[model samples]
Target: MTTWWLMRGDVRVGELRQYGVDQPTFLCHFVSGPGWEAVRELFEAWAAVQGPDPDGSRNAEAIRPLMDLGLTLHPSDGGSPLTCFKGCILRIYGDRARLRY
Candidate 1:
């Protein structure tokens, strides 16, 4: 299974946020499975619109819109699809960490 993280602060600052949910609580919410395909689609669209690597050479700013979209997609759930997917992408791409305010 893929793991996710929630990072605090912005691309300017590399601060990481603690996982807000405990494992049991996180597991409960996450068991339902988030729409990763939708998340990928949104991220690709955002990246295309934002252009490549606005902040760093890695273009962390492109992920900002995905974080915003997560707020809409995952509503009351404490587990964030944006954060999760961002972590996934970072790992997949083997790129630098990306964070958004």
Candidate 2:
């Protein structure tokens, strides 16, 4: 399993986890915060495009919204696999974070 942190600047807003090898399942858990609605919409859109399997071309399309929101993917440091998957990180834009405040 791989766990990714969804961060808005210094604050953490959500998490994503990937499980399985032959058939990987990605789960996203996000907290209520700025741009939450947009994020939710994007998730829904992604799901709609995903069909039965998440590893589809639409997956890339789904991630585009996140990038537009200034979210970048990063690799997390070494951690317990039971607690978190290794090398998974996503950060929200600082500018967007400030807008929420």
Candidate 3:
């Protein structure tokens, strides 16, 4: 299993868990934060685009807010995943911290 922590500075905001190797599925959870509303809107927009076969360009636009928020994706065991969104992966060490996400 591969876990990615979404961090804002020293605080944890969300988590993304990847399961399966051949057909990977991501389980994501996000917490309420200073910019929760904006994040929620972006997430909803992303979901709308994911109705069927999501468009890569539209999906990129949808996740742009998350990137702008400086949310770093930290992987467990200090190793990078094979694939990721926008190629935005920031490796960090340590166990999973407790947070709303």
Candidate 4:
């Protein structure tokens, strides 16, 4: 039971530009702030769906939220059971945070 939630709007990473860079890079954002409970829920759900990867199952709940957040994956890359999320800002100007399981 992987639960997914997409971002409805552009995410804001505070304090950037000072370093002088371009676009921001992020895999995901938690608008409600970093709540460990949420992370745990997401992680558990993802793991459940992943099960034994040998079966080659896709976790819809986990992936849906990611897609809703506007996080686009490179065409060259395929999705995996491992969930990796990042709270990031412009390379040179913004800040960064990571959420992985």
Top model number, lDDT: 3
The C-alpha stretches of model 3 lying farther than 4 A from their native spots are 23-38, 50-57, 80-85, 88-101
Model 4 clash pairs?
4-65, 5-65, 6-68, 6-69, 7-68, 7-69, 16-93, 17-93
TM-scores, all models, native as reference: 0.26, 0.40, 0.49, 0.26
Candidate 4 stretches greater than 4 Å from native: 1-8, 11-44, 71-101
Q: Which pairs of residues have clashing backbones in candidate 2?
A: 3-85
Q: Write one digit per residue (lDDT tens) for candidate 3, span 1-101.
A: 55665656665655655533332324333334453344455555655664554556776776676567665556767765323245543221122122221
| lDDT over C-alpha atoms for residue 30 of model 3 | 36
lDDT of all predictions:
0.35, 0.42, 0.48, 0.32
Tens digit per residue, CA lDDT, model 1, 1-101? 22333233321111122234343232211221234443445445544544445456345555565556433222233465454444333221112223222
Better of 1 and 4 by lDDT: 1
Question: Candidate 4 lDDT (Cα, whole model)?
Answer: 0.32
Per-residue lDDT of candidate 2, residues 7-101 (tens digit):
44554445544333332323333344453554666655654663555565666766576555544333255543221112332322321211110
- State residue 26's C-alpha deviation in candidate 1, in Å: 19
Model 4 worst lDDT run, 10 consecutive residues: 88-97
Clashes of 1: 1
- Cα error, residue 15 of model 3, in Å, equals 2.1
Candidate with best TM-score: 3
